[model samples]
Target: MARFFGWLFLIFLLGATYFWQPDFFQHSYSILKHGDIVSLAEYLRSFGAWSIVVTIILFIVMTFTIVFPFMILSGAAGIIYGLFWGVVISWTGEVIGAVVMFIFARYFFRQIIAGWITKSKYLKQVDDYSAANGFKALLIARLLPLAPSGIITAVAAISRISFKDFMLATIFGKLPPVIIKVLIGHDIVFAGENMTRLIVLVIVVIGVYVGLWWYKRHKDQNKVKY
Candidate 1:
């Protein structure tokens, strides 16, 4: 029965990816880059109480695919709903997306994932380390802007980290970056000659990239030493 369900999920996931990916890949990120959010928001508001529901649903789909990552949706959410509601909606959607992917990867794709991880020493190391230090491993990685949310989900799933640790780490780790992106979006949407906040947001983004670069350099150096 379990094996049957495993195959069932795999087939369904494959079909969904095949049929749904082309359209999404072509335009999803493009929407973020160029779509008129004011118009989009107006359309959403036409849905009345269901507008946020539609937003959450689309957000979850995008997150689960792990194609665009969380940042793309983060800014848009804030644009549509302001910072506080944006953060709440984004946090919920991202968490649900991660949990769904994690479960599917851990169960339905375990064998395939195991084979792939064995081919990469770094991934194997992460898996082993996560098994030992679930909370710290996930929290630290998720906190780092360098760490892609998709990879974090994969590692946690493969390692089968406890729900408590995974849940806590995800909540804490994802909060700050989500806050940053949403604020940037909010400021941009409501900007009226006060460009200082935008300037600061840009600086913060640059700092995140620089920090990631420095950490990677240090990590690589340690790797060479060992």
Candidate 2:
């Protein structure tokens, strides 16, 4: 079947990418851990446009497999490309990542992803909510600032939400937070010498954590209700 080859091609692509860049996984983790994004960006940009291509590939693959948090990469983009280009590159990559995963999940992996999600009490609530208020529910979830974007993509694929509605919501819900993450990166870079930037970075980091925590509690309460 065509679906079978699609999976095979993707698996081959992932394997080839890994083998070609043997340390890619480790390096990605290092990028996140050190947050010394200047060095990473410098290294990548040295490859010229190939660097952007590779970064986009990583974003796409990571989006599908949930390998890295988008926030980490968004910040790295800021360090690499500055504010405006960072937003442009990061948002483009994210939209591509989200749309690709949405298609794959909807067409080829819907049953599989839904079966997996049906196991979760929280996601069952998501299923019900998405069915009743497809665009609205997904839009809110995406705007949660730190909710798992991959899970949302999977759910949207399985739910009755139209593709247009999901992508529109993605545009609206994803852009602002990504901008903030980019700004966070800028602040962090300046934080070394500027106390004000350091303070702002701290506040943003804390706010992201607090927002995620609150959403988790809210989701848990909804789980009980659903």
Candidate 3:
């Protein structure tokens, strides 16, 4: 009964939000489409004392829905709250949202997903790899800009990775990207005064990818030797 209700509630929440909240989502889309950070910040500020709470809630909702890109919200956080607080708000919301999704996916879909994995050698191998290196794998995925957070969370939730490993990896792994996005968002709105910093960030991102590639190649070579 409880499980049935849980699924029902999830469906209802998504459906209601999607259908009933067209105006709010439309406005959000407009803001993101225009890349209007200042306007977003102003809109959040209109909530007065509850602005932070509103921002956090937005992050949580956006996690699963992807109504608009999370990057826009992170940048808006930077505009509204500055560097430190922006990162804090964005990280807190993203982590919480991710954890919620992880739990839900694990609870409701793990068994079904496990069955599917068993039927596919490729999926089974991927799941095994995730179970073995959940932390490192999840962290790397979080760092990459193109990797979808929702898919990563769902994959980890269904794998053999322990909750502790997932939480620790998520908390630490998400910080760098959140911080970088927040900073970049701030810089974008501030007339590109921090162009040097942006350039450095780009270089750092490239370095991370290069390092990951080298590590993978080295590991593959060792595997072949053995």
Candidate 4:
């Protein structure tokens, strides 16, 4: 009964969020056009209560095995909470979702390789490192968006990676991109022009290249069988 209401609530939330995307954009635009930074921040902060409510609501949805519900909620968080708290709430929801998926994979799908994943040599290498470095590899993977963080958690769990390392690495590695995305969203909220988008893209590209170069020199190659 409780699970049923959870699913029902998620369906309603997803519908409201997706079908109303334009509405959200217009609402944001209206707020930004008329309100200064302090007023905008206050208006957004007022929605913090709604954000927490939605996060909790999505937590229940995730526990019931609905992934789309969480993604929709993440976007809604960005739209409603205005990036900073959006990242915080979304990250919290995602980490919890990853932990749930980890547990589910361990208990239910221990031997299933799902063919798409089994064929990748790179993925195998990552899995091997995930075994040894446990959390650090998870953290790096989380930071880079090289792999889905949820998958990292599940693979780590199935491989019996240390929980302490997994949690710590997940938190540490996921922080950077979350921070970056929040800043990007904040800029979009304020920039009010297409030139800003172009500038932001260039900056992100440079950032990615630098990140890759840094990894090439600093990443530990010895831990993997490759």
User: Which pairs clash in the backbone of model 4?
Assistant: none
Candidate 3 error regions (>4 Å): 15-22, 214-226
lDDT of 4 by residue, 123-206 (tens): 677656656877666666777632445556666766646677877876777667655544544555555654576377548847
- Which is the better candidate, 2 or 3, if ranked by lDDT? 3
Per-model RMSD to reference: 4.3, 4.4, 2.7, 8.6
Q: Candidate 3 overall Cα lDDT vs. reference?
A: 0.84
In the range 1-226, model 3's lDDT, one tens digit per residue, is: 7779998998998789868868766777688778788898898888889989888877877777755667788889998888999999999999998999899989988888889999999999988888888889788788775456777888789998889989999999899889888887787777468888877876876887888889999999999999
Q: How high is the CA lDDT of each candidate model? A: 0.72, 0.76, 0.84, 0.58
In candidate 1, the residue pairs with backbone N, CA or C atoms under 3 Å apart (3 or more residues apart, or in different chains) clash, namely none
Task: Kindly report which residue stretches of model 1 are placed more than 4 angstroms away from their true locations once superposed.
Answer: 1-3, 6-36, 115-125, 145-147, 191-194, 216-226
Q: Given candidate 3, what's the lDDT at residue 49?
A: 92
Task: Return the top candidate by TM-score.
Answer: 3
Would you estimate the TM-scores of all the predictions? 0.75, 0.76, 0.85, 0.54
Q: Lowest-lDDT window of 10 residues in candidate 2? A: 186-195
* Model 2 regions more than 4 Å off: 20-26, 112-129, 193-226
